[model samples]
Target: MAKKSGNAFDFGLFKRLVGYTNPYRFTFYFVGLAAVLLSIFAVARPYLLQQAIDTGFVPKNENLILEYVVLMLVVLFLEVIFQFLFIYFANWLGQEVIRDIRVKLFDHMMLFKKQYYDQSAVGRLVTRAVSDIETIASIFSEGLFMIFSDLLKMIVILGFMTYKSWQLTLIVLAILPLILYATRVFQKKMKTAFEEVRTQVSNLNSFVQERITGMKIVQLFTREETEYTNFRSINEKHKKGWVKTVWYNSIFFPIAEMSSSVTIGLIVWFGGLRAAEGDVITLGVVIAFIELSQMLFRPLRQIADKFNTLQMGMVAASRVFAILDTDARVENKGTIQLKNISGAIDFDEVRFSYLEGEEVLKGVSFSVNSGDTVAIVGATGAGKSTIINLLNRFYEIDSGTILIDDKDINTIDLKSLRSHIAVVLQDVFLFADTILNNITLNNPDITEQQVTEAAKEIKIHDFIMSLPDGYHYNVKERGAMLSSGQRQLISFLRAYVTNPEILVLDEATSSIDSHSEQLIQDATDKITEGRTSMVIAHRLATIKNADKIIVMDRGLIVEQGTHTELLEIDNGYYKNLYDVQFSTVTE
Candidate 1:
């Protein structure tokens, strides 16, 4: 959380938001100029009315009345033009600022280390990126400059009122402190209300987004009623939050209107008493004070509302800057760019832990020679997949070293290091796009012909052609339009098309049907023939022919040998595991 500079608004945060306008300073000046002109025109209307009534009526001069009326009309016309300019330019400036902010935020998130994503919710980030920034835009269009214009008009009207009749002006002034106090109370109350409203918005967005993404789970488990009740509970809190703000507005606006009416009545009564007593408070002055009172007090009420807008905008700004200020990105200080890699990997006593003090890879050591197919098998939570993650530098290690082609992996450019390795995980993900787009991922250099050739190499081109639109078929979100087996095939083709120097399949075939499993095995064999490969599989039969098999149990490599050699051990770990799996299949 950002430190607040004050109770209601943060001065530091407001200044930071204002700094976004540095790029749009020309629009800032235009809005400022409009506010000044609008304030003068607003005061001139009532002032001209008072002058025309008193001076023009004294001589009964029709020409004088016509001239003042024309002047008032001209002033109204210019006010309208500048009002349009003010609103248009202010909103334009706000949109441009958010555009740049959104881009900067996205680019920052792109480089964030995997742990940040593992800890944060996707929907909450979406709310910060989309709706919250929208609230900040209101700071310009309906907020700060609008509030400035209203406050300026109030000051100018008070000056004219005092000059015209000190006696009547005193009556209006008598009510000023009460309304101003009420406004301050209302603003403080609204500050807390807006905070609740923003918090509820994020919760609601996160809940709905998660439920939609997991709708399959909800339906499969027959928990629709339970989840619906949960949604209603969250939704009720959101409604109550908004209702609290509305309830405050209800009390504040009526009190403001009543105060304005009382001020106008006091002006009329006082001015009449002075005129009867033969004092200098004339009827024209009395009428003008009513106009001035309306002009002044209405803005006072609106200022309270705009202050609420400014408050809400500040709350949103704090959330956005929190993400921008995060030091969650991996430091890429290496200058070495990989020209080519020989695909030999060495992990010398590497140590890693996803959580503090709970090591997943505990001083583990291993190696994979060039063009060798090495398979790693382990029970769940035995660190089989941690090796793959550490290889790509997804999570930094706490100790020891990982080398690719005898060069410390950390000494290679982050992008270049990952570019030479391809991973196909158990849970395949596809975007809501055509198969071709998902395959190339909009990489300009990955031509359609190259993807087709890669698909043929994997023998999935025939299956892809059987789809409705072949490679042009839309997979929908997360490949919902296709079966689980087919999604795995696309993932295989995706990895193959990259032509990586090293391939890692972390149980990629574990969730597929037997037919898809056979297809994947064939593709895997062809792709790993000359390229270095690492396979983490639960199905020991699939890796029976591997050149070397590393058996892991509780974060330690307990056995390392080929299939026939491992089975030759007296009650070896691989023999026991292989016997249990095949026996389970027999049962």
Candidate 2:
């Protein structure tokens, strides 16, 4: 999980985010130039109106008035062009930078250790990857560049007003300090509110995602009203988060509007008094100052809003950088790479714990020769499945060594080591794709024909062809369209098609019906024939044919031998387990 910063503006995060725009530097520069041009052009219309009123219309010169009007039209056209350029390039730069960031974030996620994911929420990560990145995009498209443009326009307008008449300019700016003070307060308050909004959004997404994923459980337990009540609480928090922002906006904007109106009133009254006192100020100059005042103060209001956008983007960037800066990735420094392995595994006094001080595998030692079938049976929490995880290096061992074909597993290339092994767990996951694609997993080297051939060898090809679309049939999300047994058969076919030298089946048949169990048993026998296999089964009757049976109790191997040898032991753990299961079956 990424830790968020408390500061409103994280300059460290801002600097790093700016680095992602390096690839699009040309577009960024062009947009900046357009912003400057837009500011210069934005002030032209008012200046032309002043010229028409003072120099042309007042003296009754038709030619001069017509020329001024024509010039104003030309300036208006140029402003339109510059405005278009500013908008298009700014959005383009934002999209390009966000696209790069998204790709980099996803690639970084791929290298993170499994433990990082174990403690992180899926919905929070999704928010970072999707919604949060979109928020950051507004920093360019709606926030930063627009702020620059508005600031520049204000400066240019101020310059023109002072040059025309300094005293009137000062009068128009009488309420400026009050507005600035209000804006500062609004910005600070909005920053905190926006952060709260983002937090609540992530919480809401997480809650909704989990509830939907586990809707079956909620309905099975008749927990609809309870879950709905929980949802309402979270939804209220989400609403309140946004309502705070609205409260600030409601308070600030009216004050800003009133201040602007007051400044305009002061300009009009004072300028009228001067005009009545025999032309110390002209109508054209007074009107121009009014327009300039609007040009100056409107951006003050807009800048406050844009700053809110900027703050949200900064918050999002801080969260995103936390993920980017994580160092909890799997280390792969081994130089050894093997194309083929002999599939001999040795676990020498291996010790491990998913959590500190709660040992799951306590100095356990075991070995399997090439092409040997080993079955591990134990009670729940007896560390039967931990062995499979350790063998695959899904979690590192606390002490001792794991080896494959006499080479330390840690010294072998991670990809090369895993390429030779396949795991089929009790809960098999299938993507929402066609059956053929799911089986080969988009491996170009493994053809559709090859998948069909593999399924045929396992005697499940006919079952697949009976479907409406056969190999091309869609399995839907998590294979929800298929029965548990059917999904397991798909898992078996998928593993068989990989043709791994080592295969692991962790309670693969524990959840299926008797018919599906028979089919899986047939497929299992075929797949494990020449491969070094490890079977973890809850049903004691399934492992009768294993070459070696290792019975475990409380993270220690209590007995080991073939089924008959273990059964010969008097009142041993394996013998007792066998007796209980045999009696249950006979009854």
Candidate 3:
């Protein structure tokens, strides 16, 4: 919730934005030169007309009049050339700067900790990356440099008017304060309106994106009408936000038009009075003053609109910079690079909580030897999955230490540490791509032949080949083209291809059918061979052959032993859970 600053032009924001243009400084310098040439050409047209009327046409000299007219056409042609150069270079510079900023913004987002994403809205971030950056682009294409050129044109026109007839110029300057004050007030109101428009746009994007992504849930629950009603409310706010801007435009432009008309009338009336007194003010000077007044006032009116563009760009820059300034990135200060760890993991009194004052793992400790298979069984919310999350350093522990191969986990390079570990969750995610690409994840080093070899070893090669396109089959979004069991097999093949030292199966078979479960079980046996494996399963039957069983209750390991040893314990948590599941299977 960033508040709007009272200052119209934030120089600090402007300077920072200008820094992005440094990479294209030569193009911008050329644009500046074009602006200066454009101003000079713009002022020459009215002055050429004055020369034709005063020295050529009134004196009835056809040759002189033709010369003046020819010169004016040449100036007009040059003006058009410079105008084209100004527009082309300005937009090119803007696009290049925004492309660099977008890359930097996305790279920065990649470094943020998972906690930052957990608290932020996807739609709001999308708005910042796409829409807000687009608005900043307008600052260059339509705003800042255009306003600069307009201001220069006005200054040149003013000097010419003063040189022609100082008395008439003084009279026209009299109405300047009123127009300036009105423009200032209009800009302030427009700034507030633009801020509202941006806010509403972000909200609308968030609402629509969430609803669309979760459309399956909405359809399952028959929430169509309720969701539609909610969307209409948000859409209405978006509409009103834009309508306010149009309303301000409606009010301001009429005032500008009337002021321009008044200035022209005064010139005609006063100039006529001076001329009737016998040859004091000529018709050409008076007519040139009319054109000059338009040149001056037109930019003044346009400056207000351009100022709005500048203001919106500043606001967008401030929001984008706020994201870049965040310090929520995961700290990767470890210098140790153990690319091939020995797979021994030890959790020494580890404690963690996703939320403050609500601990999920309270001083839990465990040890898994190299190449050993350990299974953790627990009721839902009993901290079984939290162990895997902490093992991979997804979330830092609040208290105690996690060690890998006798070295503190925090002391290992993050990439090297995770490289040796692979995780296959119950809800496996697949990108919208070919089976081969998804399996290898487009890693050029991991060849298509390597992925096929891994799939064949995991016994999923035949199943994948059964598809119409085999390895080239498009999975579509989230692998929707495959069944739950098929997706699990793909996940298994993905992990197996990585050849990680430590493999984690977090309820990987919890959501599949008996057939799919059997396929996953077979794949799991082959993938976990000679690797340190930790399996979190609710189904008691899945881990019956695990070398060691750890039973957890309320975030504490209440029992730990082999299946037979645990079943021998009187009323042990493991025995109780095993009996209930076993009885259900028997029935």
Question: What value of lDDT does candidate 1 attain over all alpha carbons?
Answer: 0.88
Clashes of 2: 0
The reply for model 1, stretches above 4 Å from the true place, is: 1-6, 275-279, 582-587
C-alpha lDDT (0 to 100) for residue 260 of candidate 2: 89
TM-score per prediction, in order, is: 0.96, 0.96, 0.96
RMSD (Cα, Å) for all candidates, in order, is: 2.0, 2.0, 1.9
Cα lDDT tens digits for candidate 3, 1-587: 23485556777778889899998999989998999899899889888898899889889989999999999999999998889999999999889988889999999998787878999999999999999999889888888899999999988888888888998899889988888888888888887888888889999999999999899999999999999999999999999989988998888888888888999999999997886775668888888889889888899889999998988887788889889989877778888998667799898998899999899988998889999989999889999998998887777889999999998889988888888999999998999999998888888888889988888888888999999899999999999999998998998898889999999999997788767776777898899899999999765555777888898988888889888899999988888888787547621
Off by over 4 Å in 3: 1-3, 276-280
lDDT of all predictions, in order shown?
A: 0.88, 0.87, 0.88
TM-score for candidate 3, residues paired by index: 0.96
**Over the stretch 305-421, how does candidate 2's per-residue lDDT look in tens digits?**
998998888778777767888877677776798767879989899898989999998899889999998999989999999998888777888999999999998898788888899
lDDT by residue (tens digit), candidate 1, 1-587:
43443377678888888999999899999999999999999988887787787778756778888888999999999999999999999889889988888888889998898999999988889999999899989999889999999998898888878888888888999999989999988888888888888888999998999999899999999999999999999999999999999999999899899999999888888887886686787666777788889999989999999999988888888999999999898888766888767899998998899999999988899899998889999789999999998899888999999999999988988999999999989999999999999988989989989999999988899989999999999999899998888898898888888889999989987898867877777787777778899999776555786889999998989999998998899999988988887446521
